[model samples]
Target: MTNHAAGSIPDAANTLVSENGYYGAYGGSFIPEILVPAFAEISRHFEEIRHDGDFWQRYCALLANYSGRPTPLTYADRLTAHFDRAKIYIKREDLNHTGAHKLNNALGQALLAKRMGKTRIIAETGAGQHGVATATVAAKLGLSATIYMGREDMERQYANVFWMKRLGAEVVGVDYGSQTLKDAINETLRDWVSSFETTHYVLGTASGAHPFPAIVAFFQSIIGVETKDQILQAAGRLPDRVYACVGGGSNALGVFQAFFPHDEVGLVGVEAGGQGRDSSNHAARIAYGEGKPGVAQGYRTMFLQNSDGQMKDTYSIAAGLDYVGVSPILADLSEKGRVRFAAATDAEVVEALQLVMKTEGLIPALESTHAFAGAFQDIAESSKSDIFIINMSGRGDKDIFNIAEGLQDEEWKGFIKRKNSQFEDQSR
Candidate 1:
């Protein structure tokens, strides 16, 4: 709320968070009483630095000099021709440092941690992009860092795990309870409960408890701010619709935040459909009513759960989208109809990724392919004059293993085996 997302939001969100961080009945800090004071301290420090002009200047400087800012806005002519309807534009957040938009929030939180005099940092990652971002920042800041990732995601995104360790971070693989984003989150929170005095938990995405969602969104709003300016300059007007893949909803919220004030622009969030919707395995929390209103991971939101309140296992070809719940900010948006939600099944996402790589020569992360596949669902109904801006949240460099498997490339799998054998021989 904090005036950053002050305009055109719901009446409840128009003011600073009232009722102890509830965003219109969707958000609140539900945590151990032992960690209450720790969270309060984070809230206090965040409020102070957000208002400090000097802090803003320092953060912006780091973004420009170290992380790179003002990522490109490009027209996808080949994609437009193939679709033969709306003109396709891309907000190239994929080009940022660490090859993803996650760096924006990582740098912001790392600086805040420094200002608070915390030395050690902990994080949970699914796709591995956030883990890499956190490790990179920690190395540059000379702080200790530990990253918790799901065992399944570690295999799927092995490249990211390698980079995180090379950047001097301890990567812990969580093996129980679905072995994905949710389990990693649980582990990170458990670590934070005991180490809150010396460690800062850099909640990767725009979800979780009270101040975290707000804090992550504030850092990520740079995407929306830049896109608004770039689209106006390039297209001579605002886009008809903005599309972004929604996992934990950080990238989607980052791209949708500025456009909230401009009611003319439509906001679309596409969730991962691991299989067909009928299969009961996908992560389409919004489009499908599978995730009912509930609390998990320290906040209340719509989560995929059974009647007994036990969490349901969710699946996605993209490791990042394998979470059980959507962000509280997004949950509120869905109820109010401010954002339209959709799901792109695993098959559809793979097809979309292949098509874009062929047509536009961009290898977008599997997580982002959900948005492209979702938008393509509208091509037959739209006019050619309409403009659509899709946020490519990250590149596919760190997703080589997942992408190869998604395409069912047997040769690449064989190559991986051969390479592993060669490395084993050398190490021996």
Candidate 2:
């Protein structure tokens, strides 16, 4: 593949994977024969439309008018003062219409599905942000929508589940395997295998099969694109480092890809370190786990696997970060030392969340809090003149229940119980 430097627009032939979809031995299509046609169709249309100016015009217009574009790049003055090292800025993706960066990809893919004449949309979500985003777009477009979520995630993120249902989506809870994001992905793929004719599967992150990683990254690149421009305007130069939390790596790849060709800009991806890396509770596949390449979820990448090559279960206080495998593009980049990987434990993430709220007056999602924690660690030894930008991938509204529980907010729990009792009484 052709290599494009930073500050240039990346075309399919340059920035993305090869024609066969291998990103330096990491990414490829490894699906069954039955799914070949669907993947090929998506690949063909995406290749055609991605280069079309009209397609981008429409996509950008929708982003600006409907979903909110050019999200703010706010200077966290208090955070910088607290750190007393790096001057910190945050790309406020949390302020988007659906409260996260997921809507960017969701809206783009939904528009593509419309172009393809697909009438239904299916997606799998962990923290339910993607599901809510997908459902919101489907409702706006007057298309039928179905969301597959793990049973455990549905319970933990019940507020998002409620919003998705209210938006007119059929929510299916997968109970197989660990009954989490991985299982939800497996179920969504099975559904796509049979329904690929009239349905479009909106894969949540920058993982999965060939076109998906590329496609999702293409949509998400808007984040990095905006950040680069905004940071230049705000700080008069590129940041010394950019940090983002990586689950399936959509947000990280979104921000990192724009800075990939910039060797001076440090790219740091923070993974979920659960309880700790010493224990098996972390999802730091590229950081602490076996970095062996293997095929799972229709792509080859580094995964948390056991001796028998079975994918191991992962844990994180943030449901979105609890994944066994990461984005293949990120894996390849990490291996090549183009990007750095770090992990923040659950405790550190919670502390970071509180710190951001107290200092910046921004309630960041738990997933984004990992990036905050990682940035704190990295900036501690750096000079005060150093500049860092954190991609605040989502707001903390969806995570209020989880955060309250994590921080042991008994008053919040009592309020929730009171509300639940009121609803129960109304139902009775």
Residue-wise C-alpha lDDT for candidate 2, range 245-316, written one tens digit per residue:
999999998888778778999999999999897898888898775557889999999999988899998899
TM-score, per-candidate, Cα-based: 0.95, 0.96
Residue ranges of candidate 2 with Cα displaced over 4 Å: 1-16, 420-428
lDDT of 1: 0.88
Clashes of 1: 0
Location of the lowest summed lDDT over 10 successive residues in candidate 1? 1-10
Residue 268, candidate 2: C-alpha displacement in angstroms: 0.2
Q: Which parts of model 1 are misplaced by more than 4 Å?
A: 1-16, 423-428
Taken over the whole model, the C-alpha lDDT of each candidate is 0.88, 0.89
